[model samples]
Target: MKNLLYFFLLTFTVVHAQDKPNILWITIEDTSPQFIGCYGNKDASTPVIDKLAEQGIRFTNAFSTGTVCSPSRSTIITGVPTFKMGTGNHRSNYPIPDFIHGFPDYLQQQGYYTSNNVKTDYNIANEKDFIKEAWNESSRTASWRGRSKEQPFFSVFNFAESHQSRTMSMSFDWYVKNVWNYLPEDDKIADDAFEMPPFYNDTPEMRKQFARVYNSIKLTDNRIGELLEKLDKDGLRDNTIIFFYADHGEGMPRGKTNGINLGYRVPFIVWFPEKYKHLSPWGEAGSVTDELISFEDLAPTMISLAGGKVPDYLNGRILIGENRSQPKDYLLLSSDRADNGPDLVRTITDGRFVYSRNFMPFMPEMRYIRYIEIADITKHMRSDFKLKKLNTLQEKIFKTRPHEVLYDVENDIWETNNLVYNSEYNAILKKMRNQLDTKVLQARDILFAPEYEIGLISKNQTPYLYRLDDAKYPFQDIYNVASLSGLKSKKTAKEQIKLLKSKNEIVRYWAAVGLMSQNKTTLESFKNKLMVALHDKYPPVAITVAAIVHENFKTEESTQLLKQYCKSDNMDLALMTINYLLYVDDKAPFIETIKKVHDMPNRNYNVKAGCMDFLGILNIVENTSKTEN
Candidate 1:
């Protein structure tokens, strides 16, 4: 009787597993909804993706929590925002709690076979083990085909044809040979056929390069069609649900790493087979929903679909199925350091208006990030800037940005206008600012601390857990000081000057940054305070104050301070110091110091990159180490 009872239990488990729907995710890299045909772009040739939208529900408002790939992928896998995880900086690989497994682990526990083929750039320490635990099979050929008979599956296929490399960074000849060469003649996009965005110069060189965006996407669409065809042939089409979306925004120069809507918005569609049609919260086939969904919502939503309990630690709401939570009123997005470029921006969007607070307002939107600076598009734009061929609007990319910017993406699709100071949008601006502040503090955002500090903290505890200790992080105080950055007023400067004496080093660091954001005239009155802060115990505070003094007063004392810190053994501090040297009035005095740091063995990538940038600006090419590691 006991043996017979065990057999019955095994039968029930198999049947229950077979009843669950198989989920297939088709993720393309670096694409925005504006570039897709389903999103009303006449120039796009994404017929397969548009057809998928017609067969399912199209999400009109979908965003990536982060603008870049690795950090965005980290959020998707964990259902945690980058700011909270301390993974906002690209490729930082900061340690997270060992118990914090990817959401797919929950699906695996529920007897679903998971596979990823095969992009696993999750941007957290111990990523190899994390990926290993999440997927039954994760390789170039990983798929549902490897799962047991009658078992449900969650399979992800990442397409790279529309990635940044194919779109802009790679040589045009390589694009033609690789992406365009495989396209059918009729599907090929013509250079003249595409309309150029107003922000870019309309010269032949620009048009020829921009046209790659269209053709590369067309190739991506073709691949999606082939995959759909294979799914039908495999006889799983009847029970499989298909999700099609991109990792982040477009891979173009101003789109991928930016904090605006163009950088975070993605093309998202979910197709439910007849077996799982009842599970979709959005209506039937061909429906479009404007519900605000971000990458953070994906993990819990997927776990909910797989019949697993959503953990409380996952902040994202269950976006679909019976457990679907209420839609978000606003989404908080972040953009941080991407490849040796230091910046911090927090953005909020209500599916129509987008607001961004540029904490590092001194750097232009198109700052000299080493990875992008080497791209052909960036080089071309730089040449155009030097020739003064670009219009005022086009040249704005290289200029310092406003402290705050608001855009009505519904009306201004290109985001050419700033509505932050406009009287009519004052209420909206205030609402967004308040919402951003509340959300950041609620999450106890750890990215506000310098990466150097995060590294030190991570040595003792994971940043995810470290942030929860209010006494250690003192986030409210730090946030209060950080929020003062870019508010151009003597009153704000006075407040920052007073806070420079805060006992907390992080708070003092932010206070110094606030003073740095002020105009030279306003800083003149606070010169004494700034000078004293240049010797503050915290290296970041001293480095920031040094930048202010070097830029305005050109004091020899401040110059020497910056030079000394540039060679500090602490790479993060060294990176901070070298970055400040890039903007100062006198680059000559720092040349030798930068060169010495540049030639230092085993230097941090950001520090070495900054040194190279400083030397490059002076047109001084020096012998440097070849490898970043």
Candidate 2:
């Protein structure tokens, strides 16, 4: 009798799982809404995504948490913003909290076979140290059809056909042999087909590069259609909820790592099958909504649909199906410290208006980050900046930017005009400024924390928690001092100098960076204090002092101090030290210091991926290096 009872319970469990709906995510890399047909661009050929838009609700305002790949992908799977969870930096291989695995773990507990048909790069390292989870399987061979007949499933398909590396095929040889050579030569767009943005020169060669990007998009569209066709043939279309979107923005010159709309804005479409239309929040077919969505929301909405608990720790809220609810009025976006160097920027968008706050307003030379320099278009931009080929509006890229910028994105699409100085929009700009401040304080954003120490913060629950337990640097003071450049008072410099004596190493480091940028003339007045800072226990602080002493005093001690940092044992610190020397002169005496790391067999992925891509321009300038872009 007990054996019969067990059999009956098993049958009920299988039937219960089959009754739930299936969720499918089809994600592509490095694309914006501007490349798609339904999102205002009719020139590009994306019939599959356009058809999907027509069948479901299309979102006009959607964004990702971070502008870069690893950080943004990390937020997508965990339903938590990397900034709050202490995984904000790119590809650091940081350890996450014990309670946090991913939304798929919740679905698995509820009886769903979750599979990712190929890429799973969420930045957080997997427990086994191979990659992220491998439920059933996570490759091209993994499929929903392979599951039991009565078991519902959740599947994710990631397409990399339109990644930035693929777009560089026309000029970059690495892209040509690996990505472009595989595609049909005949499947190309017309030369000079689209209007180039203000950031790029309007030349025939520039237009040709843009054409290659459109062709890659075409390949991704074809792939999406094939996958959808398979769902129809298997008779699972009516039982599935299909979502199509991009991971982040395209990597076309200035678009990739920057915090502009071209970086974070993505095309998002959701196709609710006719039978499952009742479960959707907006059941109207072919309808469009102006609601804003973030990458962090995907996991929570999917977990809620699987009849599992949504963790309170998630930064995102449900945006689709029955559990959908609005959390805040505006969507926040940030980008920090990519492979190029240490850069910090934040943006707040309320669907139409955009307000940007640049904390590091003095470092305008970052416009030539290594990955961007590899593009043929940027070469034209740099030569134009020197030759006066560009207009005053186009020349803004070369110089330091103002503290704040405001844009009415609807009218000024390219964001060419700055209205922050304009009196008419002062009221709107103030409200937007206050809105951003409220969000930043509420989240306790660790924008000023040292990037090298972020990995350790992740293991101790989070940066915020560690600060609370230890009370180092008085967290809020660092953000205030980092933004001290905007103030004209001499007292601000005094405040930073006082903080230089702090017991905390990270606080002392940023204080030195702030003191130099705020007022270098005042630095000589505190030579005794500045000399003490030159020998800081932290390399980041000592490195900045090296730049200050060399740039201001030009002493022998500064050169020796600079050489010591160039050979730092930590790879991240070593590369940053090299970048600091290049910021002043075309070449440094310690170029061989970084070259030795390139020779080491035990180097980390961060050093391997960078290899002074930023500093390699010296060799290119000398016409000596033969490395790939």
Per residue, candidate 2 scores C-alpha lDDT tens digits across 140-192 of: 78788767777888999988889877775246565556455665666556766
Worst 10 residues of 2 by lDDT: 620-629
1-629 per-residue lDDT for model 1 (tens digits): 99999778766765788989999999999999989999999989988999999999999899999989999999999998999889999888799987677988999878798999999899999888899999998999998899878988999999999999899987888998999899989999998997898999988888888999999999999999998898999999999999999999999988989999999999999999998899888999999999999999999999998898888888788887878899889999999988778889999999999999999887888877766765677777877776677899899988888988999999998899999879999899999999999988898999999988998998888999999998898899998889888888999999999999999999998888877678899888888878888889888888888888999998999888888988888888898888777766578888888888899897978888888777765652121122111
Highest TM-score scorer: 1
**Model 2, runs deviating above 4 Å:** 1-11, 127-134, 169-187, 365-369, 386-388, 456-464, 467-473, 485-491, 519-528, 586-605, 608-611, 620-629
TM-scores for the candidates: 0.95, 0.90
What TM-score does prediction 2 earn?
0.90
Q: lDDT (CA) for every model shown? A: 0.88, 0.73
Which segments of candidate 1 are over 4 A away from where they belong?
Answer: 1-12, 620-629
Candidate 1 accuracy as TM-score: 0.95
